[model samples]
Target: MTLEHKRPRLEIEYCTQCRWLPRATWMAQELLTTFEKELGEVARVPGTGGVFEVRLDGEGVWSRKSDAAFTDAAELKRLVRDRIAPDRTLGHSER
Candidate 1:
């Protein structure tokens, strides 16, 4: 019955063979910090074949395979905010 359970959950799936855990972990930290109240939990899911995807409530918001690039912190924050807290301003991230 905590806010954590009520809010949405984010999942970052990264390729283990590609050594993307640090990148995924960093993104998770950024999201958890920015959307602390808006997000229920941020999970790091291990995968393979150079996969790096960000999912909110099981829906993908960003994918390296399709986007052809890793999402920057600001862009990731914006994408996440738009989905979970559209009205919330991301301060410097808005720039």
Candidate 2:
């Protein structure tokens, strides 16, 4: 018998403005904490508007987990509501 579980997931938008976005790091940390609570982990690649692969421990990440982690999406109304805007205000892929 096997107990199936959902994989942990997070999206990180690395800065493409040449300057670092500290908030992005904070976002990842917050996700790590959230996932950790569920006994899961994430796989991340460091790059501007980078994609992250998330899953349970031992289920190493794959390229498929990646997507558009950057850009100021109109869909991110919650992100805008939740945090202060960056001085740069440029999404990872903006450049």
Candidate 3:
């Protein structure tokens, strides 16, 4: 019998005190729409003290505080796609 590999899970942790839920939700929606089949799940985690991070399988992929900027939708898509589906084309998002 062949074993099936599990898809990657995305976690977006945003600061609740900073009111970043809308941002996190937007990012989650974008990721879900872009990688609906490639991703196993997308989770929104509540945080504090200006924390905004994205992780795949518990590994940090992007951090707003560290980067000093919010991650763009296309950039985040590329980052996630590279890890989950390296060969997959992102069409207009490539630019």
lDDT of 2 by residue, 6-40 (tens): 54444443444544346445545654543354434
Per-residue error for 34 in candidate 2, Å, reads: 3.4
Clashing residue pairs for model 1: none
- The C-alpha lDDT values of all candidates are 0.92, 0.39, 0.93
TM-score, per-candidate, Cα-based: 0.94, 0.34, 0.94
Distance from true location, Cα of 81 in model 3, Å: 0.8
Q: Candidate 3 lDDT, tens digit per residue, 5-73? A: 778889999999999999999999999999999888999999999999999999999999789879799
In candidate 2, what residue range of length 10 has the lowest lDDT sum?
77-86
lDDT of 1: 0.92
Error of 1 at 20 (Å): 0.4
Q: Given candidate 2, what's the lDDT at residue 80?
A: 28
